[model samples]
Target: SDGQMPQTREHLLLARQVGVQHIVVFVNKVDTIDDPEMLELVEMEMRELLSTYGFDGDNVPVVMGSALCALEGREEEIGVKAIDKLLAAVDEYIPTPQRDLEKPFLMGVEDVFSISGRGTVVTGRVERGNLKKGDEVEIVGLNKTPLKTTVTGIEMFKKELDQAMAGDNCGILLRGIKRDDIKRGMVIAKTGTISAHTKFLASMYILTKEEGGRHSGFGEHYRPQLFIRTGDVTVVLTF
Candidate 1:
């Protein structure tokens, strides 16, 4: 909650790009506003802002509360029950999108490390499909050749598991690949999705001035961090 806020347009665009179907806004500090009319005004303003982002007011859940007071164990006045109600409503209203697991699995590697005698370990969020122990996987990148690997082990939330579905953040052990064969920001996909060469067409927006001048255009040199499947990669953006 303390992190830098994403710009409204950027946040909405990213949420849409990632296939998010609903947005929930938890507005803390209700206790700070003593006037009931002011609270209602704030809620209306939030709804209007979210509407501008294309989220239907009827679909999104917005809750107001005082998190700090609730943490101090002052439950009744701090409105902790409101928070719980919002969570329950979300559970009922928002359904998690099902991934096309039958499609070729592709994950973006976020981190890679050595696991002593067990060999290379890669951590990534599964972007698509379900990964199970003994499933053969391939590590591919725009700049390098594809490397073959087998899932020797899988873990979710620090517990070892036999399988992981899409949307799970997992650390996987690869039996045949070396640590040098893969890198953070490469992609792990089924063999057929692997493509060679750094050039590929993509749809992208000019994110920031720091990303370089506007008419400079998209090309191999503009490698923005791309989050796809369970993998995150630095991609050379091509128009």
Candidate 2:
């Protein structure tokens, strides 16, 4: 646990922004404290801080432990036992991923490479559905029209596979598609399914330097550079 560090709060805010569903707080450095009353006070302070940030601090699992004890080769100092408890909590509380193999296949093209004599190979993490050998898929991205292609093969860790499902990071060989058309940020899915976002509306926080100066008073028609999902794009703000 970070106790009451500014960086800890900032990191938690970042996690919230990025759609984190669950959080497991491990309160470290319990070995340094000799007084039980002082340790309880620290936990109470941490809980208050968490509650101030709109979290269920009292309800959230806060496991106390000491990594220093573990590093010093001590097992009875509540070091490894705390870690074991955390692991058990994770398995008991955290929900497993619910992947629907019935949904249409979707995978974003992250990196494209040309394997010698293997045609155009695209690597990405599957988002939904299943992709099998000889499955027909479409490429959509880079502001270009869609092109239909077939999945010649699927591979994970150099092992050839007949199919891949959601959450699988694998390379796929597309038949008849050239490497020139393959680009990052492209979506590979069933034809007529992929939709590329053209506009974004988000509240931008002045995180870095808000000391003495507030956000820029750009009232209307403010044009700004937007760092969007995996790419940078500029957009005009219509007030």
lDDT per residue for candidate 1 within 177-236, as digits (tens), equals 887888777888776775755455656555554323344556656767876544465766
* Candidate-wise lDDT, in order: 0.74, 0.79
Which residue segments of model 2 deviate by more than 4 Å?
14-19, 28-42, 64-84, 100-102, 178-180, 200-214, 217-232
Query: Which runs in model 1 stand beyond 4 Å of their true positions?
Result: 1-6, 13-19, 75-79, 205-239
Give the top-scoring candidate (TM-score). Answer: 1
Clashing pairs for model 1 are: 107-231, 108-230, 108-231, 108-232, 125-230, 126-229, 126-230, 127-229, 127-230
TM-score on alpha carbons, each prediction: 0.76, 0.71
Provide the global lDDT of candidate 2 against the true structure: 0.79
